[model samples]
Target chain A: MECLSDVGFSGATVGVVAKRAGVSRGAAQHHFRTREDLLTAALLHMSENRLAELRRRAADLPDGAARTGAVVEMLIDAYTGPEFSAALQLWAAAANDPRLRSQVIPLEEHVGREAHRAAVDLLGADETAPGVREAVQATLDLARGLGLASLLTDDEPRRRRVVGQWTRMLEETLR
Target chain B: MECLSDVGFSGATVGVVAKRAGVSRGAAQHHFRTREDLLTAALLHMSENRLAELRRRAADLPDGAARTGAVVEMLIDAYTGPEFSAALQLWAAAANDPRLRSQVIPLEEHVGREAHRAAVDLLGADETAPGVREAVQATLDLARGLGLASLLTDDEPRRRRVVGQWTRMLEETLR
Candidate 1:
């Protein structure tokens, strides 16, 4: 994951990743036959880690109005940092690579669904209600867009204000 | 632009782009000193085209309630298709390449602010009102996130639903 985030997909070759992990190239090859295998495993590992982190944070979320704000914050945090960076690299590469696209699409769909389910739970949102599901999706999408903005620069000040606004909007929608 | 969208950053070398453009490599190099120059120019060209298209669409938008929905649809349209796909490739490459990052950041900032301003204008939104600016920003962000989603799958059905929900939210917020 670090390899992908730091050097990007083009640079994260098996030899480089193996060296980064302090493992021999042959040993890395023994575990994963191709670069695709290695990359998919890395992304999967990162996704699981992200879900685990979200669950961990949810356990400690405050109740009531504060919970909505906390949930928005958690979702934004989920889309930033090294893990998201790695995923972005893969996503960009996968956009043009057929084999990588096939691997990434399903993984992304699973992660996206899981994240949506988690958000629904964290926000105490009832999806059956009109506009409820789309509202939750909008919130997730906004978080992702904010993450993309942060990749180029320190978008925190603007991002914070946006998050504050979104939290209020989400609270109203869920209510 | 097509090269970037079709083949990605690594594949859209000057030689390849020139070939696609039916120009000699030397002629391409004469116009753009490096691949970075060519890409920046392409992105700039695309941005200008997008902004012009937005203005053209804005001129025809209906008055009152329907205008908000039209504006939201326009915003979502701005973030999808080949132009956005090419930009995505550059953005991903720029994330790790400082030279490209320096160029892309300012360009993106310019494009983002212009899009935001355009949205504010089209919706007749009052940014001075509390949360109004952030609401506009969120709308743009959601459009961008939806664009990312569509890169891998046909997300139009869900995207349309989200846009519908957002149009309502935006209408209320602007009110």
Candidate 2:
């Protein structure tokens, strides 16, 4: 998926991914019976990778405040990182593919739920409070958007500033 | 740009757009000397159209609250609307083209500026307030992201709820 998204998904061939991943074409074939299967697996892999990365980044943080801070920084890094760029590109490709959409939507919802839960735990807020989860999720969603937009522009300073502002804004909810 | 974006800018031939817009090939060529030019012009044109729609929507309401409310709704509509989907597809294409990026980046910045300005005016907040602009822009960005995500999933209720939550969140920020 990374190779395909990075280079353009529709044009991504099995041979390209095999070569890129340093695996034999036969080995690649064994793993993915078809191109569509490869694409599906890659998308799922990326979603899982992102969630794990978020958790790893927030692991050392003390609570909601620390977690919010850590999560913002991690999210910034995630969006701008080489790996996540591939993921973002895949997401763009999925936006245009119905098969890809079916695979991606539920994962997306699950990720949103996880992030919301984390934010609640981090902020020490009541998960059921009116607008609380929604507000926090909105902040998370906004951070992801800004991060992706900044990545596209290759603007590091802007990315840092946006991330910093987001961390601060999320922290505000704690107060 | 909408046509190009809708179809994947690189994949979208000028011929397709001319056909989609119901204009002659010659007419399309006449208005846009090159495909790149057409894309730039299209995105600018759409932004103008969006701004115009926003103005009309907010026309009945008082300046601050009305503009805030109306702009958020307009943004929701714009992101989910047909034309913007095309523009978004073009955005993906632009990600791969440096020339297209040059055209898109500035326009994106302009929209961000316009959004920030509107928020400031509506909230009666100073632009220089440390995090005010960032927060407002972040919320708008969040709405757009959620809108895009919702579109990919065919979730109308999720879309409606997020849009409402977004408006209410912004309302809280202003207060």
Candidate 3:
């Protein structure tokens, strides 16, 4: 997944993936036969790993402030990091390759919906509430944009401010 | 830019780009000596073209209804299309390569800020208003998320619905 995100889909060959993992090609091929299989497995692994991380982080909420902080942090770590990077590669690749598209689109959408639901829960907000869903989506979307920005330029402080301010904005909007 | 977005940094070699553009390798290299230079030039060209299109689209937005509709359309087109895809490529590519990061980060941020300002104007919103900046930012951010989803799947109807709903929400907030 990291390799795919780093070099993109066309470059994430089986041999490259194996070499990046510090394993022989034969060892890698033993588990996954083709680049597609390897990449698909990696994408799934990334999504599941992120979901677990979100749950663990949301395990103990200290207060409203801490909860908000946790939510923002999870949003950044989940969508703006390697998970998103890999997804970007897959999304672009899937556009051209129908086989991969059929496999990737649903999985990618599922991850997005799952993240949305988790965010709603973390905020202790009802998705059905008036304007609540849009507000929540807005927060995540803003975080994504900030996260994308960070990828271009590791401006941690600016992204921090944007996400923090966005969290507060959502609080008021939801209220 | 399309090549980078489609195949990513590593796959968007000079040869691939030249082929994609239907130009000779000599012709392509005459303009950009290296892959990084080619991609950077392409990225800038994409941004400039989008800005021009935005300006042209924003030319005669009608009253409240048409204006909101136009804003939503512009938001969707600007972010969800190839422009964002290429930007996504540069973004992911810039993550580890500091040289690429340095080249891309500023360009990405500048494009972002320009887009934000244009969005504000397109929406007829006041950037100086209280919470207005964040509100505008959120609107663009939500559109971006919707756009990203569209790239993975042909969720045009759903994305259209989200953008329309968010536009209404922003109308209430901005007013």
Q: Could you give the fnat of all candidates in order?
A: 0.60, 0.38, 0.35
Candidate 1 has an lDDT of 0.90
List model 2 lDDT by residue over B24-81, tens digit each: 9899999888887887787778777776666565556556555566666666666665
- Stretches of candidate 3 above 4 Å error? A5-7, A19-24, A62-70, B5-8, B15-23, B64-69, B96-99
Question: TM-score, each model?
Answer: 0.98, 0.85, 0.83
For candidate 3, lDDT tens digit of each residue in A1-175?
8887677787789999999899999999999987788888888888888787777877777667557766777777677766676777677677657788888877767777887888888888876777778667656666666555555545676566556656665666566
Docking class of 1: medium
| Candidate 1 global TM-score | 0.98
List candidate 2 segments past 4 Å from native: A63-67, A118-125, A159-165, A172-175, B62-67, B122-125, B159-169
For all candidates in order, the CA lDDT equals: 0.90, 0.65, 0.73
Looking at model 2, give its docking quality level: acceptable
Using DockQ as the yardstick, the better of models 1 and 3 is 1
Q: Give the best candidate by DockQ.
A: 1
Model 1, residue A148: distance off in Å is 0.9
Error of 2 at B65 (Å): 5.6
User: Order of candidates by lDDT, top first?
Assistant: 1, 3, 2
For model 1 chain A, the run of ten residues with the poorest summed lDDT: A80-89
Q: Pick the candidate with the highest TM-score.
A: 1
